[model samples]
Target: MAGVLHRAALRTSRLLQCSKRPSRYHNGSLFFSTSSRRPLMALTGFTETQLTVRDAVSQVCSQFPNTYWQEHDENERDPTDFHATLAKDGWLGIALPEALGGSGLGISEATMMMQAIAESGAGMAGAQSIHANVYATQPLAKFGTAEQLESTIPNIISGRCRVCFGVTEPNSGLDTLRLATAASKQPDGSYRVTGQKIWITCAQVAAKMILLARTTPLEDVEKPSEGLSLFCIDLDRSKHSGLDMRRIKKMGGRAVDANEVFFDNYAIPADSLIGEEGQGFKIILHGMNAERCLLAGEALGLGYAALARATQYAQERTVFQRPIGMNQGIAHPLAEAYMRLEAAKLATYHAARLYDDGSVPAADVGVACNSAKYLAAEAAFAACERAVLTHGGMGYAVEYDVERYFRESLVPRIAPISREMILNYISEKVLGLPRSY
Candidate 1:
């Protein structure tokens, strides 16, 4: 198995020809090395760092093929081997700070890495296995104290501590500011949290959770966004009393577990809080945009993968002694899907670039990220649908793998944020229209 993985990794990595240029950091900014020849980069305009990340991540993902993901998805098991392989290769720390045992690369490189992973036939399930690690810790990395950075960041990057993001709740839905989860301060400066968090991914295996709860009561605070606090707290049910998790049987991406976590007066140390008190809504917003960008990349990759499969099938599957691809009716939709995927790819990468630049305005970043996510998810769904239609009967069969892709495509469309919400945001924020919802 090890030898197979090594050879496959090498074969996949050889597909991309990168320049010998290196990416370096100077004064907390990443500068990618440029090449004059620009091999395979004229179309995408990917820098050395981005291309290198894509190549390396594709190599890692190639080891776990479509069948590997299918089996895990069927059995409802986490792809820990795939996760550990990327972690061992230092891919998990692509967007983290260098001083904290990471490569200190920007979101552009991280987005490329995720796209490569999904494009390598792992689909959304594979991309989601380590998704939180890339974005959930952004707030901690930026606002954490010296002690928090020194102890927590290194351990997470090293894969010693796997963490899950806990923000969504059954009652709150998308109204995050109205979350009822409370973290009351105690005499010893510890917090006793009590509430329920639903749809938390990888909670079954994660050792820590980035939890957002109300530190000050809603009535006591002037703004709904205020009174909220974020915490990087222990999630061990065995170690901590009054904490319970019930695994949720989801529609797709079953490889990673989603749970409804219950915290009934679960006590956490005071040091677990991230950033300042009553500032969690602001801090988590940083991660929310990053998550949207990453999800967009994942959606783009899934679309591309599905399109590749459909195109290959169309060319090989013959009907009436001619390839199905020869028919304009069959060919045109695949071409359209390809175009959609390509367009979404551009939007996704553009959002990542805007996010990493740091000089761009927050409203601009929000627009780009939300638009990218909405476009990518819609495109991916269309591509997957077309791929399944192109396959006809085989599309419904799990053996063909398009069925799985089709099911998993819904993830990007409905998760982190919905298409309707994206439209609302663009309407209110971009058009300066009155609030609709």
Candidate 2:
């Protein structure tokens, strides 16, 4: 894994150099492949395997189209059939290793699957439904003990279990170091945790929780980031004592329930700790880039979906004895939206490839992933907005589904990390600017 990361950095550096300097055509011909010129495929340069994964996921998604997702969104219900269908088809473990009964692919493949899901018109609701299942297991895969891995990972891959990521707090927000969540060590080697978590996706339905809590008092630690630990706890949400989970209804992505959770005195066994004590922050950082990559891909898919819908409507809807698409007023915005989405899509996939390369430095991965996330979110939102405008009043109507797309597009701009934070990251980490926050 370390080698993979290192290689990723060198590969990225080389790509940058080539992009900056003129390419020397050592080959006799200067002609590039048609795939390079293609709009969507050019973004990712997906391998044959990845393309196959895309097609397969698309086929599965086609079963439950916009109509299916619209119903789920309107009812504010979980896309149980969509979620189960993907899990049943074994698409849930696209990121897990084959040894653990997974396909053993990388983040690129995972993003492809996720993007296809979103592009199927499932939108954020579709992507969020299975997002944690595909992602949150990595910390365990990379850092957990033998007994822990043997017991937990298989069930996750097989879709017998669902785990909710418990990290963000109501008050702490992005400043994780100051979170008040605490887990005191018990005489029996277990830990008693008490904390509040907000925006915990799928908490209402999750059977397990990958939790992070302060193991040692922050004042006692050398750094604020120290003294924290990660744990995987059995979270059967039947309103048990010391465990309280409540659903928080929101405007969009209603298919997946985001919740507020309170752990009054949750007891977790000693073996549930994912990695070494006081090192949870470092371990958790390992999967952050992957998370960003997946989110970026999802956003890209949504943008493209919106663009497709808008262009299709413009071509079909006739006004003044000609298709709306024939007019520059409608055609130009759709064209611009297409360009923006394609650019963002390229960045998103490029970051995914770099993440999968396993050779990039952590700092480098952070820059790429954050940039991709920011670009994809902005682009997707723009596309959705334009789609709504192109449809005019019909876009605002639920019958057309563009309004839903427009509403759900707001998710990527705010979640995982905010656009302002991404800008701050690039400025401080990449450009060597003084920390703004």
Candidate 3:
């Protein structure tokens, strides 16, 4: 198995011919190493670091092929084995600081890893199963105290501690400012959190959670974004009386559990509070750029996977004594999808590159990240739809796997943030338009 993985890693790494070029691009300004010949088939012109991340993740994912992912999805089970594989291999900390027992990589590298896994036919289920390790755990490293970091980061780096995020509210929906979950201050300075959180991924199995609640009342606070606080707390299932959880069945991504949780008088220690009080929004926002970039990469990968499947079927499945790929009806959509995915890929990686650059402004990063998410999600959905259409009846079959991809593809379009919200952001922030209702 080791030898097979090594050879596969080498072969997969050869997918892109990246010349000796320094890859760094600002918001729109690109800087490339001078080479008369460009890297053939290099869509985003990845650097050596990004290429290594992509190849390593692809090699790991190669072990769990479509059958593995499809089975987990069909059974509605968590991809715990796959998650363990990645954690054991230290892929969980691909972007973590080296001192924290991670690879000390950047979001760009993490993006490559996710895209590689998704493209390897694991789809969203495979990538998202461990997505929190990279994106959702950012608060710990950025805002956690030294004591918290020492106690927490390593467990997460290993497979010992799995985490989920709890921020969305059933009533608030995307209006985070209007969330009603309250964290009352106890006499001992601890917090007694009582609220309902929904759409929390991995809640069914997570040992920890990054929770956000109103430590101070919204009416008392000057700003709604204020009065919000962040907590990294233990999701002790034994606390059944305090913490109640129920799995939410969905159209896709069944391999991972999404749950609606109720926290009734969930006691949180003072030490579990991250950063300053009433600054949860800022702390959470610190990780949003990375999250958006990584999510975009996942979306781009799913698009590529769907396109690859459709193209393969077009080539091998003959019709009227000719390959369907030779027909314009079958070929054009795939070709169009390729272009769309390529465009989205460029935007996704560009956002990652921008975020990796420390000199870039925060405002620029927000615009780039939002735009990348929007484009990548849109392209991925379109490609999956085309793949389904190309497959016709076979596409709907479980064995074909396009239906799974199609179902999973909707995740990006509707998750983390909606396409409508993203558009509103761009209109207000980038285009300088008045905010729409």
Candidate 4:
């Protein structure tokens, strides 16, 4: 697998080689066939398989243009049609194990697929509509019993059901090891859960939730990470009397709903537990690195999308008898943003490749993933801000679309993990400094 990926990377680099000729055409045509007119496949060392995934995902995304995303954002409606289209195309299974009806692709391809979705103008909202399925189930897929895999993975891949991740809480925030949600064991061996989870995306529509809760009180455990358990619980409110979710109106990514979830005596069968009890922290760590890699790719795509729009506007929008792109002030920042995004893209893809290779050390993978996510988020934010500035008055208008990109850029910066936390990690782990947090 590494040999094939290495060959494909070299092939992609050759394809991306820019000739010294004045004409934009390389040999005979543009580097990337996608409408975005950017060599995204080449930017991050795409394998042949990855290139195919990128193009196919980009084609799916092309059907849903900026106008489609604009209407969804304005109405704060779910992009179910877009999500359904991707599922129909079998993209939901891009990173799943083939034994369980998935495409069996690695995180590298998944990152490319997500980047294509965002670059095609779906932004974070479009990519996020189907993001959880790709990463949240990693624990279950690896450690789940045959019964769980046979029943659950197929439905998710085939779009018969949707799942949401429920790890964050209203009071705990980033202190995941200190989660307050509790799932007490009942006499019948079932579990009765009661707790609140905040900022849960897609709770309004998800049929299931991958939840983390304390099976034993913190005081009873030797360590804070102990006694925590993970469960795949039924989130269908109609079937469960105590399960409820209230939508939170957010600043961006309005197409998907974020909610505060309440579980009052929610009953889950004994079979719902994933992996061994008290090992939830260790199991979920696998998915967290995957999340960082995918999120970084999503951020890079959004940045490239904004930069593409700004570059086009600069070239076409005339001011004072000449295109604004003629001025160094306008062109230089866009150029810089492009360079920053490209650098982040490399980091993002490197982290993803490291994740898929599996030969790298776990500590190294964690550092790469967190650093890529942090850099990509910051770079994407700058690109969006510059895009808005390039459009001047029209940037704020929904029709222009940069404002939406700018709003959605904040998601990667804050979700899954924060920039500050990533820094603290690098400091203590890499620099061998004392723990700050």
lDDT of the candidates, in the order given:
0.83, 0.80, 0.83, 0.84
- List all candidate RMSDs to the true structure: 7.0, 8.6, 6.4, 4.7
Q: How close is every model to the real structure, measured as TM-score?
A: 0.91, 0.90, 0.91, 0.92
Q: Which stretches of candidate 4 lie over 4 Å from their true place?
A: 1-44
Error of 2 at 432 (Å): 1.1
Checking candidate 2 for backbone clashes, the offending pairs are 4-358, 4-359, 5-358, 5-359, 5-360, 6-359, 7-359, 8-359, 9-359, 9-360
lDDT of 1: 0.83
True-vs-predicted CA distance for residue 425, candidate 3, Å: 0.7
Which portions of model 2 miss their true places by more than 4 Å? 1-44, 238-240
Clashes of each: 0, 10, 0, 0
- Itemize residue pairs with steric clashes in candidate 1: none
* Candidate 3 structure lDDT: 0.83
Candidate 1 minimal-lDDT segment of 10 residues: 24-33
lDDT score of residue 197 within candidate 2: 93
